[model samples]
Target: MTERLMNTLETPCLIIDAQRMDRNIQVMADMARNHQVNLRPHAKTHKIPAIALQQIEAGAVGITVAKIAEAEVMAAHGIRDIFIAYPLVTASKIERAIRLSQRIELIVGVDSLAGAQLLEQIAGRHGHSLQVRLEIDTGLRRTGVLYDQAAALAAEIAGMPHLRLTGIYTFRGSLLAGKPTLDIAAAGKEEGTLMVQLAERLRAQGIAISDVSVGSTPTAAYAAAVEGVTEVRPGTYVFHDRMQARLGACDLEDCAGSVLVTVVSRPSAELAIVDGGSKTFATDIQPGTEPLQLRGFGHILELEDATLARLTEEHGMIELGPQAQAANLRIGDKLRIIPNHICSTVNLHNHVVMQRDQAYKRLPVLARGMLE
Candidate 1:
């Protein structure tokens, strides 16, 4: 059967274009290889072993996860090297981390001495050493230590008998405030350079800094050029969302994923409701950028372009201009939506159907809701 024929069998399901996905992966991999930076794409985007293996085969050094359960899923699939970008503090989670370290080469992020001490004790009791990376709060004031304090944390981790200081990592996501693509890139490069400088300072202070990881899809293209950054861990680039497009980091054509929903009802002359609501397209809003007023949860892809629109729980409210609304959009017709944030929308589904021209396949979202 043709791909469209098969797609009719799966309604309200995510359909991934395999060819497009492969192309996106190759583009990023080629970029990293050409720039001579290690590529460790975050697996949290797809959260499927099949996609993860595809990335690995395309030359990913390893995979980055946000939770211990995600690491466990990746490890079960024989992903030998995994890095949990977030810090693990609880005793049960620390024990789980220690156990996972025995099976795979694991690296956990640390920002505090207390967290380091807890992990060190767990590693000591388990008779195995843990690899720890100090997270530097370059610009994103999330879960990272200040650059000056990074060296101190590195020193503490280095002194712990059961923990080994491997490198420094940072997420330059704070650069995505507006459409300042060049400014964001410059800021990211500066932050990465400072991170490398701090790493060098740690080395001079008798601390061994092996890896310097920096990433943010908005900043990946430029951050890779930073001198001291050894690896780039961009995750959202794989599925370029509307936000990425607005930031000029990717073209709309580079978006490989979309929500397939049917027009359910048109109760007014100026508005139409789509079957996809908050449950399908997610309620995440993309901030407006000059030259493009983005005011909704997603952009409706027209034949040649797209328009911004809002989403409700069970319906999508699209405000159509006179010429745009005049186009005959009958009930039961399907439309594709480029989500504002691909990662958040993806986590809402259980499986993603794959298609390319006339071929079709189905893949389970193996790591959905593994956020513990």
Candidate 2:
């Protein structure tokens, strides 16, 4: 008989600490409450419905996702309140989004007049309106309309019969990068200030704003405290990753997810190869205010100075620094790795072997590959 379930399981699998995850969820929920804002954490982090329910039970007002397919997955699992924190432009996606709205309290992110028009067309065909939060560009400069341009767009969107301009949101991803004197409260304050200013601009034009949302796990803790930030959409706080630890979003012990891999080769004194590779880990570098040109793709928990230096499709190359060499790892020895990006890392896996009270069980990544 197998000595234990873990011993019989394959390497290169995803493992999550259930207690750590619960604490992370509770803390974020409490933080949002203390800040007097609703916690609508992004679901793209774990993509697991059980965790989503855990968050709701912990006081999260709703769940947020990056795609309509993710929302569909959540709805199938009976997750009724969802915010698609991404812009939907394609017709097929719009049609699907409309159908999803029929079954849940759905809110989507919109940035452009063209996107608004497209949503309008979808609503016209479906005979129902789509609720949207205007995405505001607050410095990280990825998506969303310019802050100055929001008022006019709000006015334009309000004219569309099939669309309802619900509120405004922004992503200050740079704030997650730790500063020597990181004032998380201040970051949240600024984000709240920016979003509220834009929301007020819309309200001045008679737009009834209800959801003033700001996001990214780095600022979620503090963003909720902002005077007008109605909700926070932090995703990665559910499964704290190395990036979150390095950014000071959470302590290293708070990271709940890791990739379990077995050492497969020791070809050199400076490097070791592992069964896990790029396909198993994520290549996303840490994002924040400071340029975290992080040196490695992932960090090995067992080897203090070992960096998952590089990864190909099927193999990971670990470069051993002086301290890492002390571990003296051998072939067949297994270790855990904290990936740089937890959200993308989870997407690469089909399941997570979760540990609770020292017992392990599995949970499906139901939303994985839901790219539609």
TM per candidate comes to: 0.93, 0.92
Clash totals, every prediction: 0, 1
Winning model by TM-score:
1
Per-residue C-alpha lDDT of model 1 across residues 46-73, encoded as one tens digit per residue:
8987788889899999999999999999
lDDT of each: 0.79, 0.84
Question: Model 2: per-residue lDDT, tens digit, 1-372?
Answer: 113645666889999988899899989888887888899888888999989988999998889988999999999998989999899999999988888898899998899999999999888988998898888887667788987888898899988898888888888764432332255567766787888888887788899998898867887766676677798888999889887787788887899998888889999888889999878997666323244555588767857788877789989999999887787888987888888888999989999989876588889999999987
Task: State, as a TM-score between 0 and 1, how close model 2 is to the true structure.
Answer: 0.92
Q: In candidate 1, how many clashes are counted?
A: 0
Among all windows of 10 consecutive residues in model 1, the one with the lowest summed lDDT is: 174-183
- Candidate 2, which segments miss by more than 4 Å at Cα? 1-6, 175-186, 286-290
